[model samples]
Target: MYLNLTPKQMVRLNLALAVLFSGVGVYGLQSDSLPISPYTCFTLAIACVVQAYYSTEKFVAKAALSNTITATDTSLTVKQVYYQCEKEEIVELSRISQLKVADNYLAVILDGNGQGYDFQIKGKAEAIIERLNEVLPKALLKNSPIKQV
Candidate 1:
């Protein structure tokens, strides 16, 4: 199951912020005396718009299951899609060598390969962290305690 981790008002707030930033950028570009760069404001506006897209929680595609495995296998491949903006890959928890949890982020390391995926936790971190705790291994959090939000 997919869960939305962003606050309900975040979408509106981000869009509003995008509008404000874009307007600022435009105004800044019009005047040569402004201390702030118009390009910087435009960049911030684009960033806000991207965050708004992420906060919207829209599903783009579902994961596909294939590549048959033997019956003796301990873990199987399953598709997990977070959001359209984030990566959607075939990652099994059993393959994870390390897990990092925090108020604003979650990181999973795979099989000591020095490669990992990091997810940014937004809005209500507690709820998302709790859900992750449910689906993920308890041992992953034994060392790292999630800070209260």
Candidate 2:
């Protein structure tokens, strides 16, 4: 089974804000009717640009990579953000000892190795849990309990 997770996205809104502020800045540069100085408008424009850039970067680096979870009979592959980049961890079905679901994140632990990978669930823990139950074996979750938030 494959699942595409929904993440809170605001790039459009941020870009829109940047454009609005940029228009105000350009107008301020061309006209002297407003009481505010042109420097203020320029500052606001620069600030907006920076905000848009960071928001876009964050969405791409963090949420974009964490966009899907794929499970097969052999393994479970999860897309997760690692450091400043995206990493895919493919754990064997038998290796996954536990699947922990939180309100906003899911953690998968590998047996013996104790290695863990966490992915953002974004308030869809229930859906993820359901999907896991369908693909994963019952024995793996015998010790794991679903916690309702």
Candidate 3:
């Protein structure tokens, strides 16, 4: 089975904010009437660009996850494509620690190192949670539930 995930809305919002900040910076550099210093505006713009870059990375990861998550009878393969590079991690079913469901995200926790891979849950969150619950072993399910925020 293959499961797909969607990116969060905040990613687009961050990109939009980045563009807006850059425009403001350019405008500040051109206009004299504005009280804000060009240096300040430029700094803000750079910060926004950094924010947008990180958000873009998150968006790319989400997009990659959307196409990944291939589950076979014995193992689950997670493929991530970022910056034109493709990475794959294959885990045996027995090595899975737990499937955690929160209000907006789902996390797959690996057994030994307790590492987690989180995927944003868009529409039909309940159905996806239920499906995960049904597929994974009861022993692997986390006893402590995540609080929905």
State in Å the error of residue 10, model 1.
2.2
- What local distance difference test score does each model get? 0.57, 0.64, 0.59
Which candidate number would show the highest lDDT if scored against the true structure?
Answer: 2
Best of the candidates, TM-score: 2
Q: All candidates: CA RMSD in angstroms? A: 8.2, 7.7, 7.9
- Per-residue lDDT of 1-149 in model 2, one digit per residue for the tens? 73342222345555666677777777888888878876776777677665555456554455532354667778887776544556677888777766678656778777746577877644467777776776665665676544444
lDDT of 3: 0.59
lDDT of 1 by residue, 93-148 (tens): 56666655565455667777858776554424555556555554455456434434
Ranking by lDDT: 2, 3, 1
| TM-score of candidate 1 relative to the true fold | 0.49
TM-score of structure candidate 3: 0.46
Using all chains and alpha carbons, the TM-scores for the candidates as numbered come to: 0.49, 0.53, 0.46
lDDT of 3 by residue, 14-95 (tens): 6667677777778888888778886776677677655555456454565433445556677766565454455677777776
Off by over 4 Å in 3: 1-23, 37-66, 81-86, 103-106, 110-149
Worst 10 residues of 3 by lDDT: 2-11
